[model samples]
Target: MTTPTLYGYYRSSASWRVRIALAWKGIEYDLKPIDLVKLEQKTEEYRKLVPTQKVPAFVTKDGKILSQSQAIMEYLEEAYPERPMFPKGLYQKAEVREICQIIACDIHPIQNLGVLIRVAGSDLEKRAEWARTSITLGFKGLEGRLEACSEKYCVGNSITMADFFLASIVGNAKRWEVDMSEFPIITRINNTLSTLPEFQSADPFHQPDCPEELRKN
Candidate 1:
């Protein structure tokens, strides 16, 4: 099968989520970089590809365009079942999805690029505080759930959708200088996941378009 194509901005947390998912599944895809900082996503050509004007849009080899990271990850799981990211059993799968949603729905949307931009006009510091607060609250809840479900990864001993979601959001939190030490479980899982080649390879800092000035040495 021909490789799929992914359009994304390097620092976008949503885009980062999809990148980690793709790598974990061992899927090959072409990366098309979009400069969100430059407002490149507003152009007509890009709009045609992503109606929501979001990054991380996927175009299949069959020429279908897909938006949303969760949807793309689900499609990847369904399309390529060899290296599965979801748990095998029914109850385990539900747990995995629940953990994944804690980040995807509860945490990510409120702290996304669009939300941040919208808050820019308001008191910038206050907006950042809001983002940090939301993130911390989410992490606290996830920490409790993870304590019960996690072994090595977020759910069970294997890397699943939960790990991918946590990795992506933790990267975002680090950028904002939110201390993960407050949530030891999350900190441990995040540190462990970061060491894996799949997670490291999918890191925003490792992306081709990543800004050198913003990179952590």
Candidate 2:
């Protein structure tokens, strides 16, 4: 089968999630880097591909376009079941989905790039503060749950959907310079996951568009 094409920006957390998922699944894909900073997603050509003008849209090999990273991820898992992101057993899958949703549905949307850009002047700082507070709160809840269930990964000794989701969000936290000392479990998991070649290769710093200054910091 031919590899699907992924349209995304290197620095976008949403896009980053999809990238990590693809890497973890070992699925081959063509990455079409959309320059968000240059406003390429706003062009009429790209807008037609994604009417919502969002990053991380997946164009399947058969030519189906899918927006939203979470949906794309679910599709990937369902379509390619060889390496499952959600493990079997009754409660395990549910727990993984729960953790994934907490970050994907609850925290991320509020502080997404488009939302942050809309905040004005001092309000931008307030928006960022709110985002950081909410993210930390969510991480605390995740840490409690992970501490109860995690061995090496978020759910068990093996990596699951929850680990991917949490890692991606925590990576976003690092970008904002949000201190992770408060959430030791999350920090530890993030450190461990960072060592994985899949996660390391999927890191934003390794992307072509990563600003050298940001990487140096």
Candidate achieving the largest TM-score: 1
> What value of lDDT does candidate 2 attain over all alpha carbons?
0.82
Model 1, 64: alpha-carbon shift in Å?
Answer: 0.7
What stretches of model 2 exceed 4 Å from their correct place? 121-127, 212-217
Cα deviation in Å at residue 136, candidate 1? 0.9
Summarize candidate 1's per-residue lDDT along 128-186 as a digit string, tens digits. 88789889888888899988999988888888988888898998888777888888888
102-196 per-residue lDDT for model 2 (tens digits): 88887788777667767533476776776787688777777787778887788887888787787789878876667788888888888899888
lDDT value, candidate 1, whole model: 0.87
TM-score of 2: 0.89
Residue 82 CA displacement from its true place in model 1, Å: 1.3
Give Cα-based local distance difference scores for all models. 0.87, 0.82
True lDDT of residue 49, candidate 2: 92
